[model samples]
Target chain A: MAARPADTPRGRVPRAEREQQMLDAAVLVFSRRGFHHANMDEIAELSGVSKPMVYAYLGTKEELFIACLRRESARLVAGLAAAADPTLPPDQQLWRGLKGFFEFVGAHRDGWSVLYRQARTQQPFSVEVAAMRESVVEVITDRLDAALRLEGRQVKPDDLTAMALTLVGASESLADWLADHPDEDPGRTATRLMNAVWLGADQLMRGVSWRPPA
Target chain B: MAARPADTPRGRVPRAEREQQMLDAAVLVFSRRGFHHANMDEIAELSGVSKPMVYAYLGTKEELFIACLRRESARLVAGLAAAADPTLPPDQQLWRGLKGFFEFVGAHRDGWSVLYRQARTQQPFSVEVAAMRESVVEVITDRLDAALRLEGRQVKPDDLTAMALTLVGASESLADWLADHPDEDPGRTATRLMNAVWLGADQLMRGVSWRPPA
Candidate 1:
């Protein structure tokens, strides 16, 4: 997908369109060559834009990588938000949301490696990734709160955060596993986690407990 | 806890004891100063050993940090192993393991921060941290397999992995939160996760699924 200038004349292409091409190029290059080995010169060439233009538009390689991280994470967050419809029952909403999230990760294995493997552990970028994660957590907490309210039940803020953290944490751990195992089905993972979590949460909320089998 | 030389002769102390002292100082310094800002001179000074002695015992700052990570993770792993007495039933075993883990994290919040927050996302060290986490996963998986066998039941390896991943990932996420909230009880965190996971696994094994509330 080397810089296709939106069917417009090359020189007259809109700045926004041109910038997107550069970003596309950067994402592909970074994902393939890794952040350190990925060269700006190649990114500029692949995007069909000049080096100075790439710089003027996107700053340095670090800034460009951050841009890629932001775009990819935003795409993920948006997908999750759209998947959980308010009209649906709480359990359906959760199930759909998990399915959608896993599908997105399954489809974008390359994007995940760059965002999670590289950006998550590296400096400055890790902060960005953390902020992104916090947003996802907030979305989950809000949905849980809303779902419980629909049942005319209320949970303490701390308990809600605990529940959200469990979901987010378990999803991330499995997501990392999903990226590693190409043979694994993304939907199955979602189902596995849903089974592991939602059912347990429902049971716990109903005061169900598991004891040692005597 | 600045370097307490044993009551016996200083230079006459055994190599193993000396190394332990150095490791103790390194863990303290790394936890307080972080990886990038931590220096060897301070660690040596704190441990009551010379800077050169630290170099001889540990290779470099990177190696020292790795050593610290290894020791801390080992302590955690051992605590978990010791807590989950196999003589107990499966749920009890799991509950004990999780409680032990969260209690360790709560007690050594600084060690948790260094081992998790810093080592997990940073390079070279991230790989070390992952290896440590894998060992933990193995421990959890093995216990799960044992527990099932006692019940005269068997599970597929992949299913066991998924179950272990859920527990490890959820615990790590909550542990991070636990470190942040000093007021939070470690025992409660363990109980919360057990309710979120173990009960769910027990139900799923019984072929139960959570449906939308009508």
Candidate 2:
């Protein structure tokens, strides 16, 4: 059953609804087969539309991938942004952000895979996905900046950026780990991370150095 | 130039050496091109040999990937294992082992990428790579066990394993972050981690945790 009107045939389907259906199918197919192995034919078939209809709505396979990435990236970033509370303390803000990340990935497994694994391999998609990654990192850096400044400690912007990136990577790696062990709670994951980063960082900011054993 | 002699060429080159070379090339190429995109032709070219030579030396593409993964996995294990001294206190041993992990990745970026990025994809590779990943988690568990025992604390084995996995994932995430910012020394990285994991873990073992700032 074609979601688009039969009379408005070929490449002329309603731009909005057609795009949504195509992206839904793209997420499913790409997650199952990955980028290189996934074919346009399968996407069209799964979307309940003809090949040309799929192409018209989504452009080339590359464009279809970008669309999928853009949609998912927006969803994740929006979720993180929405979860933030500027009124809350820095650690609480960071914890909310990390919890949102894990919860989002758990609920949207296919979307996360497309963004993290599938989009990373394809050429143009990688650059586009990376920009979204930078946005997320910047969000974390801004929070870390406020946190460190409150303690009268200031790290170089570059170090802050690296720390943000490390936190993001760690969250991602842990999210995947949590995926495998589904019984674990996101709150616990976030707590573990805060202990690793914020607690240690507070001590460092206070000039408390952990010395190596002699 | 062909490494194997004609008469004994069929089985000529010592299995260990040839296998090492093949894996070396495979890690470099696969890390760059990823699994599905990496071609045997390119791997053969990079290895200073022929396509047939790769097949002869390392079996199919999947097999070569496994070989590369196995080689890198062994190096990571050995590096950390040698550095982790059971004779030392548990905290010191964990610090040493994590330091070894960061240093190993710093010296071998290609191997790290192959093991982290490429191996997690799917199929014949994932089955073994997942196992390799589990062993790494086990190494962390061993360190956790020693540390907890010394402190006269007892916890569920599975909980410790999960936390250990969290630490390893954090280290790995930090490694990838450090790769982009080369100025961050592994010693500094190790110290940061020691503060994060060892200090917080020490506090947790003593049943102390920072509460919400109200």
Candidate 3:
């Protein structure tokens, strides 16, 4: 396949733009070929850059894969952060965050697959991906804490973290489901998750709990 | 490393017992080497069987991986089923299932990793692994439906399935976390999930919904 033109007037592309181009190519390649099978040679070819340029810009295939993960993760996190309005009630904030998340995943299916599916499965990248996931969880945990404080309700920090992690996990799994079933609406996915989590969380905040029938 | 004796009699072993042994070896190897890197030769060496024997018993590497997934998934499902007493209320049934799930993961980290972390990321094995996850979700969905019915409340069937999927995803993610932090209590993980999911579910059953503060 003929390479896509690399930015601008023809000869030399700016470093920033070139880096983005390489990352775009790397995400596609890594998503298509599982990390082990994906090669820098193909990535370079697809990015319309030389092999040495690819190395100079990204270091190694591992680094390039991590770069792709970080970029996609940052985009996702930033999108959620932008969508969540703190002034709004906690549930609305969560709804906005979920909507941003599903929309991002729906738009960037390859990025979602690479970060959540491919990068996560490999052992070497686990720490990096875990850190990314932790940041998202931390955001959720903070929100849950803030919401609880508003109601004068207290919960253990660990419990809050677990709740945050579960919310993140549920969103992720549903995002994967959304990724596969492209016809499914992201808004509906977001609503489904919001209903599952927020309603449950609101109950917990009210000190309501389910007990086994005697 | 010297292989463990498949059967102590130094003669032909029963097919069922021998299959279990091979499956155990396959789970370890697959978890360590991943499906692509894992080979029949290493599996045979680990299982104290010949390469031909490995193929004859399990068919091929793909089939062997699927067999391993099936076995692990079955064990997990069985454990949950056994723990969840139908005589108990739905919340308690869910609690029991979650407890059984965490206990199973804590006891069999390798099996959990293979079925969840390793097998799930690859494209070729998605269908098989998905089916395994679906069964667990189906069980959760049924319980949620039953509980809702007992409460004289009703929700869309699709919503019930979505809730079940979220719970499964949350539990699986927490299980992954439990596998990583070996010291973390599985019961605590289960409780955290029960709090996050069941509380919200009960609230929804009572027609409680969270809306943005006016």
Which of the numbered candidates is closest to the native, going by highest lDDT? 1
Which tens-of-lDDT digit does each residue in A141-178 have in candidate 2?
Answer: 88767766765567678656656766776677677666
Model 3 C-alpha lDDT per residue in residues B1-214, reported as the tens digit of each score: 4664546662567788788989989988988887878888899988887889889989999999989989888888888778777777666777888888998898877667766777766656767888898899887778777766766667687767777789888987898888888888888788777666756633422334332112
Model 1 docking category:
acceptable
Between prediction 2 and prediction 3, which has the larger DockQ?
3
What lDDT would each prediction earn against the true structure? 0.83, 0.70, 0.77
Query: Candidate 3: where are CA atoms >4 Å away?
Result: A1-13, A25-55, A59-63, A122-127, A150-154, A201-214, B1-13, B24-56, B59-65, B85-87, B121-127, B149-154, B201-214
| TM-score winner | 1
- In model 3, residue pairs whose N, Cα or C atoms come closer than 3 Å (at least 3 residues apart or on different chains), thus clashing, are A200-B200
Q: What is candidate 3's lDDT per residue for A1-214, written digit by digit as tens?
A: 5665546352566789889989999988888886888998999999888899899989988898889889988888888778877777666777788888999988877667766677665656776888899999998888777766766666678767787889888998888878887787888888778666655733432334332112
Better of 1 and 2 by lDDT: 1
Grade the docking of candidate 2: incorrect
Off by over 4 Å in 1: A1-8, A201-214, B1-8, B200-214
- Docking tier of model 3: it is acceptable
* Candidate 2 regions with alpha-carbon error over 4 angstroms: A1-18, A28-51, A113-115, A118-131, A200-214, B1-55, B60-62, B110-129, B199-214
